[model samples]
Target chain A: MTAEPDLDRALVQHLADLARLHLPAERLATVLQNARRIVAAFGALGDLPLESGGDPDLQPVRLRTDTAEPPLPLDQVLANAPRTAGGMFVVPRVVDG
Target chain B: MTELWQLSAAGLADQVRRGSVSARDVVRASLDRIERVDPALHAFVDHRGERALADADAIDGARARGEPLGPLAGVPIGWKDNLVVAGERTSAGSRMLADYRSPFTATALQRLQAAGAVLLGRTNMDEFGMGSSTETSAHGPTRNPWHRDCVPGGSSGGSAAAVAAGLCPLAVGSDTGGSVRQPAALCGVFGLKPTYGRVSRYGLIAYASSLDCVGVLGRSVDDLALWLAATAGVDPADPTSVAAAPTTGAAAPAADLRGVRIGVPWQLNGPGLDDEVLATVQTALATLRELGAELVECSLPSVAHAVPTYYLLAMAEAASNLARYDGVRYGARRGEGTSCDAMTTASRSRGFGDEVQLRILLGTFALSVGYQDRYYGQAIRARELLRSDFARAFAACDLLVSPTSPVPAFPLGSRIDDPLAMYLCDALTVPASLAGLPALSQPCGYTAAGLPIGLQWTAPAFGEDRLLQVAGAFAAATDHHSRRPPA
Candidate 1:
């Protein structure tokens, strides 16, 4: 082994929290192992002689005209919503006050 | 008589347009073939027989009315589950969106349908195109048509399997990394990942947006050429789509590769390749030499950094893309009596498979506090190196060749539990993906045990015409492509 991962359980939990995942304790163990291995494998990139230039963004971002086109109909947009009320998505209350 | 389902897309379309075979007959034959073969392979998620038949009948009616027929007239094909078909469920092989119906169709599919192609069904894939093998599909794994126990590579495994098993003449799959080409190699078919932005990704479910490409898998280069010709062009709806004229269907392969320079990358073929696979590819290279193409040795040393760069960028994008799968608008939901954040978390926990979750977590870490530059940023820099490496190599060679997958199809369950091992399967494929170049995989030869080995050919961006021409030539000179798998 090159080196044991510098990761620990709290960091794993923190990552899950950031990603909005609630993986179970047992699954976390496996994620811990897999995540560490993947990240470690990422260490291989350091071996390359890389030159950073020109924003490193290969995709060209094209902007359309300023005029707005009609959006998807509200009903069509809400077609897949599990819960809807008054032509809008229904979700748990965000603020108690 | 050749079976209707067994004909190439171009061949079948020609016959249909000539009125010798009705579109309905082609659709029926494809559906019947799927019925006969899909049980063993699990290539499809939902059968759209009723809708497909209706579409086929429409095409026939148009023909009867003497209306101009489109290029893909009457050809039946499969779409990977990640692409949207209005009024059809696009699960992306995940339970999260199992009940979701697309409000609008993808632009690429719209183009294909306008060209008179009948959509037979939505094919299976890894849940959200995460896994290299189809085993991560919430539905089931798609078995290789060549061998039942072996895998059809993923996340486009089902599309590849359907084409290989003669269920459809052509299918559309997304290649984020080697999803399309790897499965194509394993299943013994032609798979093409066109240059980035060559095909619109408007309706393809995002999986690592930068790297994901809407690819095609078919039985022949002509079929792939036909499909690409129909679907490739600028889409105003997709901002990233480039303005390129649609390519014509492939001409017949040339008599010899007089001016073609084929590069054999030392980085692509080296240690860890199966002995049989290496031998089969070497034999294919010898065949190329006989066709008058000069073989040159080239090195893309940065290719060694491809896997890590691809994963880091793909995972970060996946994390951002999949963030839309909250319980609010669509997909599976949970946690009824809790706050929105809690409910969303619970729903995602219940929805995403292990592999997807792990990637998201890893991606989150890479982009997290203080680590973004070390992981995600470094990966981008490495990607630039790979892109330039290809540029330097192409300056000398007309095209490059390698085995699509280091080995043929592995056993279905062999690497499912080992994500790293599964990631390594794309060792030869991801480099082209990272560079945004056009690449195609076609059946070149077979291993001793009868598994197929694929010959991968890649050309510079927007070089699909030349790529198809070279592959078509190689296929014409050798009969390896004509050897069909026993479904």
Candidate 2:
């Protein structure tokens, strides 16, 4: 009741697709409702005068020299993958034959 | 209470180093304490007492062989689940990486272990550091040690609760918008979020790349100082880490804090603030004055807009940072042997909790082609305004002070279903996060119902030394930080 939110079924589907998440039909309504409410609440930031500038407090990222270093062992690299073969991660095939 | 577990981190380290106490016995005592108290608290998601005991024995053996002892030799500490320890499970309190063992330890954690800090276990947190109350943790929420019915303010709630309950003398947590300080306030302990770039972030499962910082929770300010000495420094592994030395403030806390200017932001006195919390912070300010601090009321008008701005930026960053967990290279997967897109969607949908998913969707929507200008772009401008407001406020005063949380810990589940209510809980603390300032929260006093209240002290970037000096002096002047919750 505090603020009107712009959440609709079509919008939820679009956002979910973009985010690469699947919201079940049953849970979609509640998720949409919550997202709408949070977006509206956070929309308060929009009220501030819009002037563009960089955050001066942000520190310059110090990049180290791009030196070749020993990489992690293959066994350790594939230790936690759900599926791996031929010393590589095996994902579902993407391209048609 | 166990005798060995009752000692501070420094005290235990000294005893162990001097051969007055064996590190094995200290670890055993802490393990016993955790077993006794953690059932009700549920603070730790991973209990590795056996591994901790073995690690402590290694320190004891090193000392036996006449090896030089590190500053934190044999002191046990807990890690928030987000920070990785090589060969250990790290989930960030999400189901996504529940079974994923780390490929390498975080540089901060590696540094601490090298300094002889023994790993106790990994603590719980809000899933991906999203929620204010830790209720969104896929692992159950951590309860406040003060009142079991109430929540520990989070996503660093578990670390704060563990330190408060004496399960460990020091626990490392992550702060993204009050995650560390808020919980420390609720749990009646010291929680310090050092300046951004103060600590390395090599393997800290990223919540918000620009905003996330490793923080420490402990019973004493000295413990935080000790932790920073061990972990804070430039790390080649983390490109954003600063080359700043751990600040060495005054030799000891001065008897009084003369010539210090603490600014009180006028914007914090608005509605939705609890009167009792305000009164507690006011009383703490009076104590600071008695110690010779001069209070100056200042203005940070843009701070009123900090919560929204902080969340917006954090969400956008999280969306980008978390895009890596699409059931490809690592982490648990679902919808096996399906199309790449379908498998990724299925895994993410179930792996992430509701709050996390909501943030992703909202962030994606904000960053979408048509809406990016209105939401994502505006938040960046608001952040600049907030930071400039801080710049102006700090120009007028040496430090900024406020209630770490607007209210004391509330009954669990009270605001779980209310997203705005949860977000508003962090209203007072997010401004510092947005500005990337160093801040600390310590127990100022307790409410009528005996719930703890936290008073916060914030400094401009790299002001950790002075901030800690004043906070440590105030802590020495008062007994608020020493009060313990009833067992």
Candidate 3:
């Protein structure tokens, strides 16, 4: 598979935004260079046929049954909070509520 | 009284049992060692000297009253920072969790404590166990005991360095891809990566859940064996933990492997392996033959793909596991922002290191919908082939042997620029991890430059007893494991 010479820098920025990372302007060149390397490295995997109607490549995790359990006491939970007010974790208002 | 700090766990335990040395004396000696060497090695992230002494006093008091004692009663052991201990900061070598204390202790740590081992301190590690060298630690790098300028192989570098520097007789480390064995090799000590699920992973900060295994590092194989006996078993809290039978055997009996087949994999003897390392490994093989083990040549054709496969699986898991660090519950918090996205972005941007950020991004791409089949899927297939190769090779041999690392500890910051070069250091070691097999690295010889080289012995899955037996026998015959670099 041919490498995508022109990568979507906007997409890269979008991911950084989603992951909550701040990329210094000067490091953008290095990030893009490294990103290309990674893309090329991962692109090699495209040669393999993964749709072979068999067991998935990843092993199945032995997940436990989900059930409702007693929650920690409000006081104990609050005690761990870095900032709390009025029995609730206080943070900068992100939502109208 | 015997110098408790200098004795192996088995020796110390025996002395305590026979009333030759009190558990309090042992703990005191260990604390003294920490005070002396730790300043130079920076091995311990946090020392619990007061609690350690208190526990030691209790153990001695119990013994005086003729109470039953655990096998490791009064022995001091260091737990890697990634392993949670109640009320202790488990920074995991990251600033994000620099002050994060666990509400509960790790099952393995709890079991060790119950077995009467005094916790010395939490050893430093790669931030979330990411780097091959401990330089990535939010706390400064752990220097190799042998040479101050050199790095002890990392992730578990601190534990290995601490044991080699005589700061702790035994320490626990986690190995996803050679974290335990690599550091032990560079530090000229003994490290054992138990079979997957052999030890509970409930409390270990997940780097790669499926590949991560709690391992032990020590100055002697006997110490490793004793520690393993104390920590290994099924934990109901850890879903992946297996109910395997515990190993039962006497320590360091003069056993011969006259008819045992030892396979030397051709793939592991690859190019670029330092000549001195190869020579040391060759000499070790000859010694094994002299001790009655049959040596044979074997091949793991797919072994070449181990590094790529391991990187994919490990990073993929790391991405998922590290998602919890998003400034939500505990860890470094970003300033309050107008939106939740802004808050998380600011927090992670400030919290994670460059290498960690790079991995997260790479993993995110690999596991993304458009790339999952290409990268993660192919790597998984490669893992299966590597596992089958080991199974096939073990059919003809009781164990496989190779040089643990291509070279002894490289100068610090030597390969930091090239991630690929750094990843190649684990080439020989990752195949075993991928196959979920037990492998041990014991000091075999030193390089011409006077650096330590390690000989790795890997066995089939659930064959830890055999692996330990062989390593113990080899260690008993050589003084390499006992030698320490001049401080």
Tens-digit lDDT string for candidate 2 (B255-306): 6889999998978754577999988887888998998999999999888778
* Regions more than 4 Å wrong, model 1: A1-5, A49-67
- Recovery fraction of native interface contacts for candidate 1: 0.70
Model 2 chain A: ten consecutive residues of lowest lDDT: A53-62
Q: Each model's interface RMSD (Å)? A: 1.9, 2.4, 2.6
TM-score of 2: 0.96
Candidate 2: where are CA atoms >4 Å away?
A1-6, A52-69, B249-251
In the predicted model 3, the residue pairs found to clash are A20-B345
* Among all candidates shown, the one with the greatest lDDT: 1
Q: Judging by lDDT, tell me the better candidate of 1 and 3.
A: 1
Residue-pair clashes per candidate, as listed?
0, 0, 1
DockQ of each candidate relative to the true complex: 0.64, 0.57, 0.43
Please identify which of the two predictions, 2 or 3, would achieve the higher TM-score against the true structure: 2
Who wins the DockQ comparison?
A: 1
lDDT of 3 by residue, B233-265 (tens): 888778888888886633453487778899999
